[model samples]
Target: MIHRSISEYFSPYTLQKVEVDGKEGYVLIDREGYYKGPDEGIDIALKLLLAYGDAGIQKALDDENKSIHLENMGFDFQKTGRYVRHGKPVYKRGEFDLFKRVWSFHCGFCGKKVSIDVQPEYWYIVDQHGIRKSNTLSDRACSEICAKHIWDEYLELWLKNNRYSTELGK
Candidate 1:
């Protein structure tokens, strides 16, 4: 049961207990059709104190929590940090507008939030069908090292898949 003030702080939203990583956690759901967590409900409430007037934190939490669902669906999320939409990567290089909206991306390698102001580099492989072949998330890399790491993972997946297909054909 969450406290009343906490509920109002995230007004119009309510908490629902849900299992995460085999443990009990709470997710925030709202009438407006927004979903926020599968985390310790109290933890999110406490974070509000540190949010420092950043309304975007709620959206960020929603984005991060999405990984839980992705993993539950058997996505090799850790190996390839990618998500696709309409057979294309959800995020693209050189696509950002800080003035228009908060641009927050989880680093492909480290899982840290990429700096909002920095233009992030995207690494992915598109197959002939225009489907992205990598399982990694299509978010930005925080640095050259992270970018290299993402590329290496994608290249490895591509090579492994190609090897399997070649073997099966013979």
Candidate 2:
């Protein structure tokens, strides 16, 4: 498993907060500016190593400073940041646009053609390989916004059915 010194684990880029149920939760992100140039190379290498173990993280550490220089050898991982392993899109248009985008999504479904939106403001993917609708599809701009209603409903139902499991996090 990946491990870090207490200081590295609690770095500013890492976010920590108490959940609604009072459990601590956190995540990391590659901080901006600090992740430029050589840091980019290190980031790629470290990610690959994360799959195996913290061997990469340890190797990246500096002999004198003892700091890994994550920005140089890996991501400036933060507990809070914008990137997500899997994120949807959110649109900025009016309700009419949302409906229109849905109509287009339906059309694509009916036509059996892939439709996709390239811009974050129009994400509307039906599936991993479905069309992109980041422009016309409000769901494509942001995944959470697109899936919030459905996800919330499903989660509510699941929680109700599985009352014994009483923990959740963001």
Candidate 3:
């Protein structure tokens, strides 16, 4: 049921719900007008948008006189995760709005979209791979139970890695 337009990301490419082999899925069209299918198509579209936005940011950074388009303004690489704001001009203004629209979805653990209006008291950022230090987006849990599950799983793996490192005396 997840569907979105690609006009904000780039030209021609669109992400829409479609029947793939009689099952519900998403589709992504390329700039060359080629059709790609399945959920991965949507994922690819997101990555493409990030890359394009990064390029624009780099361009503006390289030249003081140059300015990035309003749509590409607040897309930053230094800040990552479910939602991050460094409070810069481009970000402080309204750049993260576009990202929010694209990332508007349900909790990764329970598949329930966290209602912004409800303001649930229990919520957690699920760093499954312990890669929060890296430039990768982590999942958000809507409830404390889901959050605990995510943390426990991550901790188990982290402990195993620690044990192995200690055994190797590294």
Clash count (model 1, backbone only): 7
lDDT of 1 by residue, 1-170 (tens): 12236556556767777898999976788777678654645566777676745767776666555544444433443454444323344333544555676656677788876554655343323321322333544435666566655655554454355332212111
**Per-model CA lDDT versus the true structure:** 0.51, 0.35, 0.44
List TM-scores for all candidates, in order.
Answer: 0.31, 0.20, 0.28
Kindly report which residue stretches of model 3 are placed more than 4 angstroms away from their true locations once superposed.
1-105, 117-122, 126-132, 135-137, 164-170
TM-score result, candidate 2:
0.20
- Clash counts for all predictions: 7, 32, 0
Rank by TM-score, highest first.
1, 3, 2
State, as a TM-score between 0 and 1, how close model 1 is to the true structure.
0.31
Question: Order the candidates by lDDT, highest first — what do you get?
Answer: 1, 3, 2
**Residue ranges of candidate 1 with Cα displaced over 4 Å:** 1-96, 117-131, 134-137, 164-170
Residue ranges of candidate 2 with Cα displaced over 4 Å: 1-103, 106-143, 164-167
In model 2, what is the error at residue 41, expressed in angstroms?
A: 59
